[model samples]
Target: MVQAYILIQTDMGRAGDVSAACAEIDGVVSAEDVTGGYDVIVKVEANTVDELGKLVLAKIQKVQGIVRTQTCTVVHV
Candidate 1:
């Protein structure tokens, strides 16, 4: 399985709503509002790297308040 951490930025006052909505997506393991350069951080898993991309592009990016996102895929050495 492929796993990733998605860092999200949202419109003002929408971080909580965005985090809650992301947590409801199928591939998302967890989503939380945070303070820093990004507003929300989410953990997700998928069967493949392509699937992970789709989850971020097709699903997570479509959430109402999302302004931008950065996806960090996990690597095992």
Candidate 2:
């Protein structure tokens, strides 16, 4: 299984809503609103790297208030 963390940047003042929406998506295991360079952080898992990429691109990124995202795949080693 592929696992990744998605760092999201959203429109100002929309972090809470964005985080809530992210938590509802199929691949998102968890999501939280945070204070820092990014607005929200999401944990996701999929069958493959490409599938994870599509989940981020086609779903999470489509959520309202999301402005940009950075994905970091977890490395077991």
Candidate 3:
């Protein structure tokens, strides 16, 4: 499986709702509101890298109040 961490930015006061919505997405393992440059951090997995991209674009990005996202694919050394 392909795994990634998605850092999300949302409009002010929307982090909690955004995180909760992301947590419900099929590929999302965990979604939490966080402090710092990003408002939410999500761990997700999919069958392939392309699938992971699709999930991020089609599902996670469409969550209400999201302003932006940065996806970091996991690497195993």
Q: Write the per-residue lDDT of candidate 1 for residues 1-77, one digit (tens) a residue.
A: 99999999999999999999999999999999999999999999999999999999999999999999999999971
Q: Which tens-of-lDDT digit does each residue in 28-62 have in candidate 3?
A: 99999999999999999999988999999999999
Ranking by lDDT: 1, 3, 2
Which stretch of 10 consecutive residues in model 2 shows the poorest summed lDDT?
68-77
TM-score of candidate 3 against the unseen true structure: 0.97
On residues 1-77, what C-alpha lDDT tens digit does candidate 2 reach at each position? 99999999999999999999999999899999999999999999999999998999999999999999999999992
lDDT of 2: 0.95
Question: How many clashes in each candidate?
Answer: 0, 0, 0
The top-ranked prediction according to lDDT is: 1
In angstroms, how far off is 9's CA in candidate 3? 0.5
Give the residue spans of candidate 1 off by over 4 A.
none
Candidate 2 lDDT for residue 15: 97
lDDT of 3: 0.95
lDDT by candidate, in order shown? 0.96, 0.95, 0.95
Extract clashing residue pairs from model 3: none
Q: Name the lDDT value of residue 12 in candidate 2.
A: 96
What is the Cα-based lDDT of residue 40 in candidate 3? 100
